[model samples]
Target chain A: MGVIHVTDRQGQRHTLECVEGWRVMEIIRDWGLPIEGVCGGACECATCHVFIAKDWVEKLDPATDEEEDQLDTVITHPTSRLSCQIIWTPDLDGLELTLAPANG
Target chain B: MTDNIETDVVIIGAGPVGLFAVFELGLLDIKCHLIDILPKVGGQCAELYPEKPIYDIPGFPMVTGQGLVDNLLAQIEPFHPTFHFNEMVESVEPIGTPEAPLFRVRTAEDGTTFTCKAIIIAAGGGSFQPKKPPMENIEAYEGTGVFYAVRHMQMFRDKRVLIVGGGDSALDWTVNLQPIVKRLTLLHRRDAFRAAPHTVEKMRALVAGGDMDLHLGQVTHLKGKAPVLEGVEIKKDDGSIVSVDCDVVLPFFGLTMKLGPIANWGLNLHENLIPVDTEKFETNVPGVFAIGDINTYPGKLKLILSGFHEGALAAQKVHRYVYPDKKLLFQYTTSSTSLQKKLGVTA
Candidate 1:
């Protein structure tokens, strides 16, 4: 099992165990983080938006068109991505990201 | 204000679970009227991801979100369940005793009232409201200089307006309101838009013709005082901060679910979900029931299948409250001709 680091809205960093094939959203939500993941990984809702660390942004696959469409619905950063779109794998070990502010 | 309508059951949502509850309750001769805040039924399935495929539904290996909702609507068609669309339940007053429960449910839009013996809240993740932007103090300008939804276009006539977002609402309003507003500006995070191509084309034509403004940025601050007119500060993608003077700002981000008036209904809420008995799925209130994602139990799984089971069991107990003196018998639709007749299917 690999591990992923997530920063909550409160700016507290938490390291969570990552299971293979699980979305980063599932990992953050399983660990009881404040990520909404409202659409349950369908990538329909942008509630699970996160900002990937600048260095780690290039390691992951680019966000798909469908993911970009959802991201357009919310305030996004250059590194912003829907955590549900980032499937966990061995290569993604040590990934770090911060939760986006909760949209009102 | 119209005459208060009387029904045996008033379902507070028209989602898949609420639609299924109509089928379960119908088998026991319980009539139902459903109310929803959305203009159409299907709740999250229709609103959030109608095109997304779902594979967990029984019998069907895979179906789109809207597909399941359509089938559920067809499944309960025989019951002829009445639906009140574009309405929200504002208040639920218990008008009867604990033994024989009765409630007067009122809606916000039209103030329609329904007196029912059983109330089923199948609201999945609560009511969907407009998703506000993350700007601080934006709430202070709500309904004044800032509006999430445009109820009256005349209110914006001759006013400087700033519309934010790349979606249809923003694009549509930008195109439609430009002709009326003194000056209109559309602010988006990126140059690309997810709205309809034709609408985007229209907005581009307006921008090209110098009829309005298009800025590639996000709103960073609201310059207006509480419920007053002013402008906004936008942070451009190029790290430049720009200010736009406007009388009104309309941000059409999207919709998010929130536990609205349900929190004031006096039911015991645990983290926005109503605690229900595993056996009946009824809320703390005797006649009021909570099913689907809105209700929590010992091992409640917020799956469509789990909600179907909850609706079926809840309907059984609801039959007890609706028809206290009538004896209920368990029967199967495959063998029981009486049950088959209720389903409108018989040899």
Candidate 2:
């Protein structure tokens, strides 16, 4: 089991029991945090975008070109990525993800 | 000049096609006044079904109607068109200019006249009137128990919410409210769902997870009185009444908003749709146009994708109507750009 750490915009931190093979968007919203998965994670809509801490970002797999293009359109404080593309695993424990704005 | 609001053009409907016309005409910097009866600019979309997903519209693979409307609003936001809502257009008469002719659009609610050089009546298939529930006490339940939108997600946060209808909108709403509402019950008049495949899959997953209940039949009656909606009585196909307890009732049976004012506007209406020329989507009335599901051309497909096709074509004609000298130059941008725009992901 992987333990994922999610920090919402309101400074609420949640340590969730990350089920294996679950997408990051599902894990966050399942815990009752706000994440507009508007397109239901079809990869067509970029509503479920998030920002991963740079230190742990390299530990995770590189985002696909499609995901990168989606990130380019989003307005982020620093950087943003689509949470639906990230899969949870045991090695990925302590993954710090931040919620993003809806304009992406 | 009775409360005269003058513009070079007046686009009567703020629908997908109507808004597209506004954007297209904006390229020429021709002023336009966009009016819609709904509280929002998106006509049928914002009024009829904001939650339903649109699969036919090209590009983005798939998108909710609300999502598509947001993208459309963003596309036309740069045009900066004026908007007036909650007011119906009562009449349209010629307000002749010394050099050219104009139209005086008189609205009913507020007797204000909007004068414009040209008019594009791109009303998408009549006013979309939502089919409301038959509960007599439903009015008393508004804000107290019932709602048209999911305004207070926390109200139904841990309660059973019953959704009526089997259409695309109904199905999409179930999926949307499923993760939010504690338990969901989808009551359909029929056993089938006209929603897309992905939405159906998600609902099926919810059902498998014991998070939802699917009641396949019609709602017979309401259970409670003021300040509460206890349960709904649904009559199954076998002539049996099944009473299911619920916190809130949502009717998504779709709209009955027929073409209310167009018949009086001097346009030929054939079978509830505006009859128009095949190539241009223009009505019998000069300087007027219609598009989308509300229109029927000799070869019109009546899809959102097709409406975009008709819209771009009509804009070119309207460009010619406004600027007779620029007609030939406007012809270069006249070809069908709907598929191209969607394919190229331009907008």
Candidate 3:
């Protein structure tokens, strides 16, 4: 099990406990943090967009082309990523990220 | 105005669940008309990810999103369901009493009205609309100096236009509108594009020839008063802010699902999902049913298979509304000759 720090749109931070093999999106959504994850972790919808902390950016695997394509559809920052693409692991125990602005 | 379309049932969405509802409702002799905001059917399957593989569909071991949609379309072929595409359902007003409920459904695009005895809200995640960037005061310029979709190309003739995003809509418009527009600028966050290779090639050719301007950046601010855009401030990738002058801004950032007008339909909503009973899958309002991902109940799973079951059960209750005087006899296509005939499989 690992824990992830999530900052929601309102700038409120919440630490969520997550099990391994679960996507970060599922963890955030299970904790009721307002992440849409509309496509149910299929990486089809960019509703689960997030910004990884600069320190932890290099700790995760690089996003695939498919994930990047989905990210192109939304207003993205330099650290923008679809949280669904990030799988929870013990190495990411204290991963910190902020939720992207909700798409209108 | 044309006459309001009269039907036994009016399905709000043309998604997989909506398509399956036609099969169930048709078996009970309930004719249906489906309305979708998209130009084509298969809602998210067709729009979001058509090629994505899906498992857990009861019979098929594995099927693509579009594959399941095609099979559902073929399975419900005998019903000959009427579809009104490119139309968003605007309002649903109950026009009948509680015992015998009827509804007057209206669409936003053409004001098309449908009067039906029963309504099946199979709209999964509401209606798909163009994704709007979360820019301050951007809504003020909508329909004036900012457009999500191009209804007419002539309106942009000889005008300075700025297109945003790296997807097909942005690249296609950049290439197509370059010829007519006095000046065209394409702005994107990254150097790489997610659009079709051919469309990207054409856009590159135009840029190479100096027909249009291409900038790797994102729009930071809309520089204009409400309803009249004079220019825009862009944050380039190199950390430099630049201002580009243009008459209109078109941001094609793909689509997003919104609850839209469904929230104002007087139905009880629990976090954007209609709470339904486990038995009928009907909403709090009589004669109006909510199924698929749009509905919530005890142990709801939001799976495609779960939606199929909800639709089948909902149809049984819909039969009660459409044919209250008649008795509903349980029959199966495997054994009942009448059911076989309804499926057009009489042997």
Candidate 4:
């Protein structure tokens, strides 16, 4: 089990508790956060974008080539990541991220 | 609820690629009928992001998704392809032998079936249905008070409506129905929302002015008798429950796209996508073709442009099985007078 801290575009914070191996996007979406997993975690649409906090950016798995390509279509921040690509584990227990502004 | 259709080609989806397929098939003097699960044509382009601008479509500098769909519909107007909206292609089978096969396509919604010489599966990401909330007795109040969508606004007028979720649908309806409804409550687990920021701002303004209520909690239990809804029990962040009077409950939980009845059809699938030869976009079954996003190839890119190219190539091959006796003569739309006439364009 892990808890993710998500700060929405409106600057409101939500601490979501999720099980291990759950996608951060799924946790945010289930709790009715601002994330729109339009392609349903397919990595085809970048609607589920989030900016990992500076400290936690290096903890998660690196983005894949397909994810990198899809991310190219969106405006990227230095710590930009697709929430769907980030899987929760014990290492990410207190991961902090902020929702990215939609490029759409 | 209508007579069975007999056509030269039956396109399974009414998306842009499927609409374009109608044009391609029409150029070869083939008649087509399209079926889609959406109530209208244009699939994801119109449904998901109609207002979203698409920059890569050929010939258009910048066309919104809906704009591209509109042009495609007009381009295929001369063909007069029949479209059956709100119907899904439930089953597809080869009627004849493998050498010379015909297809029989049926839809689950109604007994409407089609007999065709060739079948084109252009179902982009398959059917898009709203994901129902996972509450236990949610199904019991499905039609009585629970609704995934609002077909009409008047139904909620003068009623205590509780709108759940934070997506575009929920926010849009909350704002739209607040003015007419007797009491409106926009309930979510948090203050954060997924809708357009401007729309959210408007909703917040309304809440601040006390026009509607904004409660931060997740619905835990539904309170009502069978076929009549009364209220909902919400579990707050502090583990406290609050009951809100609600005559109607609209849960915009989101959508789930499945292959749907297409999976039952005997076709080779790779990760739920139809495996088709790149040459003709033909599936393992003869006379049956899969195109658009529903199909997968080694280098398949699920883009509208890629689907358009696949549709053109698939049409050429479909011509062989649809009219085996006629020799196909490929011609550009710019130079072919026959194709121009077919498009109702005369020099």
Quote the positional error of residue B259 for candidate 1 in Å.
Answer: 1.2
Which 10 residues in a row give candidate 2 chain B its minimum summed lDDT? B336-345
lDDT per residue for candidate 3 within A11-76, as digits (tens), equals: 989999999999999999999889999889988889999999999999999999989889888877
Candidate 2 structure quality by residue, lDDT tens digits, B1-347: 45889788887778887887776777665678887767787776765457767787777778877888888888877678888776678788865653354678988778888887778776775564454554556677766556655655677777789987665767888988888887789876445566698998898888888889987666666778777888878777666889998888877644445567777987788866888886777777777777777788677675677777777777777666677676434422345464335223356
The per-prediction tally of clashing pairs is: 0, 2, 0, 0
Candidate 4 Cα misplacement greater than 4 A, ranges? A1-104, B134-145, B150-161, B166-184, B189-214, B220-231, B235-240, B245-248
lDDT, residue B26, candidate 4: 91
Q: Which regions in candidate 1 have their CA more than 4 angstroms from the true location? A: B345-347
lDDT of each: 0.92, 0.72, 0.93, 0.85
Q: How many steric clashes does model 1 contain?
A: 0
lDDT per residue for candidate 3 within B1-347, as digits (tens), equals 95599999999999999999999999999999999999998989888879988889998999998999999999999999999999999999999998899999999988989999999999999999999998779999999889999999999999999999999899988888999999999999888998899999999998899989999878889988788999999988898999999999999999999999999999999999999999999999999999899999989998989989999999999999999999999998889999898888996
Please give, as one word, the docking class of candidate 4. Answer: incorrect
Candidate 1 lDDT at B231 equals 96
Question: B1-347 in candidate 4: lDDT tens per residue?
Answer: 56788989999889999999998899999999999888899998887678878888988989998999999999999999998998878888788887778888888888798999989999888787766655657788888799888988998889999998776888999899999999999887556677799999999999999999998767777888956889998877566879999999998765556678888888998878999998999999988899888999898888899999999999998898888899999899999898898888985
Candidate 1 lDDT by residue in tens digits, B1-347: 47599999999989999999999999999999999999999999899889889899999999998999999999998899999998999999999998999999999988989999999999999998999878888889998888999999999999999999999999989988999999999999889998899999999999999999999988888996778959999889998999999999999988999889999999999988999998999999999999999999888788999999999999999999999999999888779988888888875
Q: For model 3, what is the C-alpha lDDT against the true structure?
A: 0.93
